[model samples]
Target: MDWITHEEDVWFEFRGNSPHQLVPGRFYRGTVDGYADFGVFVDLAPNVTGLLHRSELDKRLESLTWEPGDDVFVQVKNVRDNGNIDLGWSIRQGENEFRGARIHDPDGEADNQPVESDKSEQTATIKTKPVSGKRRHVGEKSEPKSAAAETQSVETEVVEAEPETEETTADDESRAPTASDVVGNLEEETEEAEAESEQETEEAEAESEQETEEAEAEEAELPERVSLGIIGDHVGDHVTVEGTISSVRQTGGPTVFELRDESGVVDCAAFVEAGVRAYPEVNVDDNVRIVGEVERRRGELQIETEDLTVLEGEESEAVEQRLADALSDEARPDAIAPLADHEPVAAVGASLLDAAEAIRRAVLESRPIVVRHTATADGYVAGAAIERAVLPLIREEHPRDDAEYHYFTRRPLDEAVYGMDAATNDVTRMLEDRDRHDEKLPLVLFLGAGSTTESLDGLGLLGVYGAERVVLDAAPADEEVAGETDVLVNPAREGADARDLSVGALAATLSVAVNADVRDDVSHLPAVTYWENCPQQYLDLAADHGFDADRVRELREAVALEAYYQSYQDKRELIADLLFDADEGLAGHVSEQFRIKVEDEVETAEANLEARDVHGVTAVVLDSDAFSHRFDFPPTALLVDELHRRNRDGDRFVTVAFGTDELYLRATGDLDFRTLVESAAAKAPAAGLGAAGIREGRIEFLTGAREEALDAVLAAVAEQF
Candidate 1:
């Protein structure tokens, strides 16, 4: 056999050649062949025999009489190899019991079965047994027993036997009696028995009713309703009423309370007395029921409150809830403090101005001034620069309506003069206008380069319109002047004339004027001669063939010192180039001074030397040789204290350079160029030549030899100048 298995269905088939069959586990339906008290015999298959146990029958149906030779549907519960099978003889097929039993027909023929009317009566009788205490006739008894035993035995036997007889009697009673007189007789007897049974039931029910009435007469009863007012009255002299607190007042010591309910506001005192703190303070709008003694006073009943408990109010409750919820192990109680005081705006601004003024003064006194000024679109002006002379003192200064205070530079005039003329023109205009209106210009000071001096001057011209100039020498070294000037000239010797000088000498002299310290020995120096000695005029000639003579004289006196002028020109030139490029309006004039001074001084010196000592000579000569053979060195010295005092008060002395026939000579202090040059000859190879013709001298030299010669020349010039 082969079986095909599907998800929810299975099919069986025989695969072998021989015929084969399969049977369900143990049970099968069959027809009853015979019956006995123990079981019924059935034919399970074509030749198989089975037994249906009497116990398997419906108990009610089994008591009813049944005959052999009946057809039945039986289930085979078990099968034996000996051809015995366990069968179930049920009046119903599987799952069809409620529809009624399937009664078997005898002789395998439907005609041999009982009629419908008979079958109905039989089923009804089998389903219902007679109640206990019923009697039976003598012929109904099929077994024998003693008196007590007979009664019990008879009752049990009659109960079992009654269903069969009663079924037949009921069928007969239900139908009209035919010519079969036996069925009619059975029905008549059954009716008479039923009538007697009805009478006995009625009498027993009447007796039960009498006993129930007697039992009902023996039980007990419960209590009645009463009032609770007698337990406690008026809450022991305090009246507690529920109401919302509408207003609260803190009077004397305690909070006086007033509450509102549906009727009206109830006045309640929170304290026992005016200054007593008996009850807890209550906040406004608290819903509460206060208990207190009602006392008569001032023609009114006042509540001398004992307890004022709040029922509901959010104002205090919310605060309390927030406080409680915020409570944490890490919370700091002292973290918050009350604000002390605050200052007015005017006071703060005044303090700030005072402090700024103090700092400004300190910087002006101790450091160089570098001013940066900004002019607003609204005509407000501000600036910064180095300090020179103190601003002129004036009393009760008043400014014009269009005027505003501005800061200005205080650097020395020489250094300030180095700034561009246009920028200085602006500063001059601003200062003059401001002074005319009696306005005070603000000032700032700094220690480093005043690179923006020209810009400040320009702003001054636009705002103040006065002759304003930055003094660069006031700063340490030539730091401030280097920022403004285009070309820095370092003269080989002091007092060299700017007009007749070679370009190198002219360049060196301008650098010295802008950044030198003055000495007493040079105190008698003529300002014009010193101006003519600087390189600025040569630079001017190179740029525009014109020099500002008045400006040069002013600068000579302003710088006024020798050592201040001797710093390296290379560093100053770098600063100047960075600050003022050639394209700037002021840069052209400054650059002109540089180129003209270097080229002209070199040309003049060379021409003068060629015409005199080295005429037609192609070989180079040293300045030191000419100096040594000519003029004698001068003696120049002064008291150090006196010199210091003069410098402190911004006074400076100068030297004069004169071009003579034998050699160009410089006179400053007690020294002359001739002696200085002779002294330098022992150390400087280039020192033996005239300063002007040094560049033309050619000696077989290694790398850096020319540069060393140049350095030597410069050193000698610095000492002599």
Candidate 2:
């Protein structure tokens, strides 16, 4: 939870004329230039590219979410003699992970941006091992056992071996080649030198043979093969591993082969040369024997490979069978019990099982899961429920300390419809992870979005890439989107009345199906999602969980308010603490802020409310853009929903909250947004009236025809009333 801060004194900025300014082991703020098969090329200066190899990264290279031109912090690993730079993964990524950054000085080898104070802190930095490569590059200053140090040693020996000039050198220089004796004397010198060379060569060969025999004997006495599940126990120890290669990634310094056994997967680094593939014949799915030293790099376990061999016939089959049996046992879930009983949820019980299985399977398989939901109280609760359920599984499955952060993700959607823009972003990121890191495609879960026809295009994009999709909506789902979705959870599809069912309720049940251990944590979640008309069962469940009516209201109100401010962020920890922990101090404080902000907005909207009567319906309209905080807390749509809830002047009335180009309708009865749009369009075709979203009765029209569109839409709503 601690983030590293990039103070001006600690990091360096480079403007590239030469790579000389780029000190190895020093942190340099850089921009993402591009990605390579081996590593990410970061440009500290215009031409200075430092390699952040896959082996150096905390997660798989493909798992990186960085884009071209994005500013990043990289530690200068080694600047080669040829000017090629090798970079190591900065454990502190983001100004540093509290903010989510990667940065550091190379080792204590350079002081390009040295802090004047704190000598202990500056010197005690992450020590980078000399990266093995064809060139064996090193930073400017030499450290013991480094390539540069060896080069320096060899130079010292050569200098020391040089003959010293005597005082007689002046006479010897004048004498030069004096006679035939001088030419004849070459025979004696050549013969003696040849004899010495032959004896030295023979002695050197004998020493090499002895060393080779000792190495072979040591190799024969191998350590026991360590299972990946318990590999953490053998960290910093030499061990052997037998498993099938799940994926292969080449780094600037090493080729990482992801080995998977029945227990788990771990990265095994094999280096033949820099930017070169190691074990070329050993491909993915090949059962292999690996001998390596288990080590921790960037918080993840890795094997520094000593030797690797492709297993043959009998050996391969035995490992393959073991893996298959283990996968079968691990992947399938035991019989599931719903968190709470509800008829609507019961209607889609079978699909819910399948959905839960898919989610659990993704975790077992190490595939990342991305939960996308609308930015609302119910939507946030739905996402949080899954997040809470899946995080423990991720931790249980992977030994990495940061596995939960890497494996599970929650992103908020502004609109309920999963549109192209959102889909494109997901596609780009998933493709990069797969192509770059050899990572499996992610499972995309839609909490409150992607259940309608409008989401078909977005869901279609994911389907094209073989990414699994799960959509859970309490409302009736479109047949088109349902058909495309992998696991659909919609009780309305089975002819059940789900109008009053909030997504939070469905998600709470589904989260239990994902990980039943968290049932107690999510028990009261269903009650928090409902703003009104909460089921008696859910409210009672909340009461049983120690969240009384007031507590539930405060939590819901706080989530709704917080969910709006940073409408895009998942606010993972904050939401988790609010929902699962529900610490009185934090919840009460946030809820108080929520109430104050909502009340202020309500007062402002009330002063600007304009009322008009069309037929028997009273149309309460507000120009939201003109009167409300458009960009701050309590968004226009939420404000409109809140406004419509309190101000119902008549038995049959519609609250028309219209912005410049868009409007939302909140009516007392079943109002068809499509029919309303059609009616409005017919009345004012030039206005280009259209339905944006049905859940909110959201309509969009030309800003130029605001008055005309508003008039026609109000008339249409009056007719529906």
Q: Of the candidates shown, which would achieve the greatest TM-score relative to the real structure?
A: 2
Candidate 2, residues 1-721, lDDT tens digits: the string is 2223333224565644577656566666788765556678787876567778778888777667776678787778788887778887665555434322233334444423433434346653433443322122235353368887776555453322456578567777777675776767777666766776677699899999999999899768888977888998998899989998766777545688878888888888886654568888877668899999997654578888989989999999999898878866765567657656788988888888788888987887678899999999999999999998899888877665667887888989988999999999999998897777667789999987898888889999999999999999998888888779889989878999998789999988988888888999999999999988998989999999899999999999989988987878999989988988846888899999999988999999999999888888887889988899888888888888888889986677888778889988888887777788899899999998988887767899999999999999888887877
Candidate 1 accuracy as lDDT? 0.33
Every model: Cα RMSD to truth: 47.3, 15.9
lDDT of 2: 0.81
Off by over 4 Å in 2: 1-226, 230-240, 244-256, 272-288, 293-302, 309-325, 649-651
| lDDT of candidate 1 at residue 86, scale 0 to 100 | 64
TM-score of model 1 relative to the true fold?
0.16
lDDT of 1 by residue, 489-607 (tens): 22211122223332222112212221122111111111222333333433343234122454333322222221123311112232223222333334334444444433443443343
- What TM-score would each prediction reach against the true structure? 0.16, 0.67
